[model samples]
Target: MRYAKFSMDDPFISMAEVRALVEGEVHFLAGVALLPDGREKIASRSSTVKVSGKLLSASHDPKEVNEAIRGRCFSIYPDVILGRDKNMFRALYSEATKGVETSKRCPKLDLVFTDGVIVAGIREEERDSKSLREHSMKPFSQSGTMDPFTSRLMVNLARVRKRVLDPFVGVGSILLESAWMGLDCVGVDVDPSMVTKAKANLSHFNYQCHVIQGSVTSLNLVGGFHVVTDPPYGRSSSAKGATLRELYAAFLSVSAELMERGGRLVFASDSREDWRDEIRSAGLKTVSTHLIYLHKSLSRAIYVVERG
Candidate 1:
């Protein structure tokens, strides 16, 4: 088994997003998760580690903790450092590795502590936040453009192997991240200016993505695409002469037709209307929904839907 440490950026949303990315059973424990081994590569914006064992209900005694680390470090090479939730516990590092380093292997063991519970493991994968930030701050940015981390999460949630489509790609935030993940991305925007800006942003990052000025409702694109986008929320952005409900219904209706069978659609919106009927009527199934509380009076809902 492996333990995955999640970013505290809305743990509920993070957990839900991670659940969609990872296969097999996943059990949650506070801010950490126990995932099946060999399935760690699918993790994005989260760190996965090989779990050696756990010190359940650990006491406050530092010596006992050091002893536990020593026992688990017997097989670990190139030394093992004491870490608490991805942060190094330098005070205990010396004590934990008194004589553990007996080889020259590069991989080190990480002992993660959450709520006084210690989980010994080796760090395997984590998201590149620095690059994500650089891509998000493009030449042109808008108010409702999706955040870089959330964009990556949505793309990963879609589980697209090669390509993704964004019907409402404003400034190309989602497309940028999608291309960074080595996926071919295409985006369409109703406004010509927004389309130009999106194309420029992708070019600035040297990502060859396709950005077109067209309405999503009338988009006649190839089928078999995993659609992931953040539709305009009707605030700080135009709804294209349609109510939020009607806009979503039309988008879902067309997206359902474009996406391949079993292709997933992950979108975020501020609309509170239940889209179950509209989603089902469009030949799609609602996989899951997550409410992200941004602040007072503004919470966004992330919907995960799949073509049936």
Candidate 2:
């Protein structure tokens, strides 16, 4: 689909990270909505600009240096990058004059990815080619889940018109993500510590959340909830009482009972075993599975499960 990308408005923001995620120009221009590692809040969005220059005069004149530099080379961007401010250019140009041959540096308006053009904000070698998926065993800051991850999750919910639920609502990762995205969220967890943490985090972010401290099994939920969770993985579990297998089984059983006719569950989990087939047999239909890393053995499996 040839969608027009709008650059974020903040001329000084960093476009290095977001640029690597998608193939081309950004959906929004100027200020890009950025989701850094472990960030709950996707910060103000920023646009990207790649500038190239050559030292001149004494190999120092801005005009001569600028003239000698490759013009269209700006289009040949690095796979990994950042967009600097125009004000930042002065110091940069000054630095280059001092016998420092900077291949690429400084911010310029003429050079940018606008109108849906896919530019290399970062070069291939700089990017981690392993498919990157944003996740958290615990939710960020609490309120609204407005990052790229939550945005995508909400779209699925809205498209299916299915009420979303997060069974392992640690600090409200999934629920908070869904709620602020304008989807109804139902969260469950046995840990009182998590429930409170989730609530506090939600309040701090100023986003709304509907969470229960009861187990998903006994909740006897009404209506239907599409489950989505980031279950505790490895040493990240605050679930001191149960094994990883038991936690997953609870999720499997809950999906069988609470999900409506077309409900879905999208969650991240640590594998003690292949859980995809287990979830399917538990009355949920498997959709797609994406593998993501959350540190070491905590390799997360992002599952999209739908009710049969």
Candidate 3:
């Protein structure tokens, strides 16, 4: 079995997105999720799933936890971390790892306590360039620009094959994450200023991607098997003189043309409409939908669709 620990702050989105990415049966414990071993292979490109590795052992007793880590190579000492319980697990972890051996040339070990159990596993290191915190200062940003973590989460959930397309790319947040994952990226925007800003933002991070100043309704390109974007909904930017319903309908129609068969599309919208008619008209099937409540008046909906 392999253990995947998620960030506790946003458990709903984290669980939903990861469930879409991985295959096979996944059992969710308190703060960690267990995936069937050898059936899943992720490149470790996630913001919510912080740690993942082969399960070494799971136990409730302190002595059994100590026995589980016996003779394991660790750089310095294993760090005990909490997933749920704070006060009680701290002392139990302290007793479990007392006088443990460590080496300088070995991987670090982490003990995660959650749901009244201690799970010991080797921590997987992530690529620093793909981190969202690296580029805190963006060249251009709007009021409702998607954050790097959420943007990358959508990209990962799209199940990208080779190339990624963002039809409503604003400042290239989604494109930046796609490029970092070593995938070909193309972005389009109706506003010329947004096109320039998106290019600048991608260049600042030393990522190469194609950006075009065009509307999604008339986008004349193909070969983006995965499409992820956050469209303008009159909050951060205008819909370029089109109503929300009209923009969404046109965008979905063009998206069906740009994508190959079985291609995946993930997008965010604040409209409460279910979009069943638009999705069916475009010959696309709705795979899943996730709703995130931001405030009393606003809630964002993420839709995953597949071209048939």
Q: Candidate 1 regions off by >4 Å?
A: 42-108, 235-240
Q: Could you estimate the TM-score for every candidate?
A: 0.79, 0.51, 0.85
lDDT of 1 at 225: 93
lDDT of 1 by residue, 220-285 (tens): 798889999988775444456777777788999999988988899998888465778989988899
Candidate 3 residue lDDT tens string, 141-172:
87778888788789977888688899998888
Over the stretch 1-308, how does candidate 2's per-residue lDDT look in tens digits? Answer: 11111223323222332432334434444432212223211221111222212211222234443443434243222111134344544453543234423344543212222222222221212211111133233344443322334324333432334477777776665555565456677778888887888787667657677878887556767857666666666544434476766667776887768777766666665544478667866877766655544456455555667776
Q: Each model's C-alpha lDDT?
A: 0.71, 0.47, 0.78
By lDDT: ranked, best first: 3, 1, 2
Q: What local lDDT does model 2 show for residue 149? A: 47
Q: Please give the lDDT score for candidate 1.
A: 0.71
lDDT winner between candidates 1 and 2:
1
RMSD of each: 5.4, 12.2, 3.2
Report how far residue 131 has shifted in candidate 3, in Å. Answer: 3.1
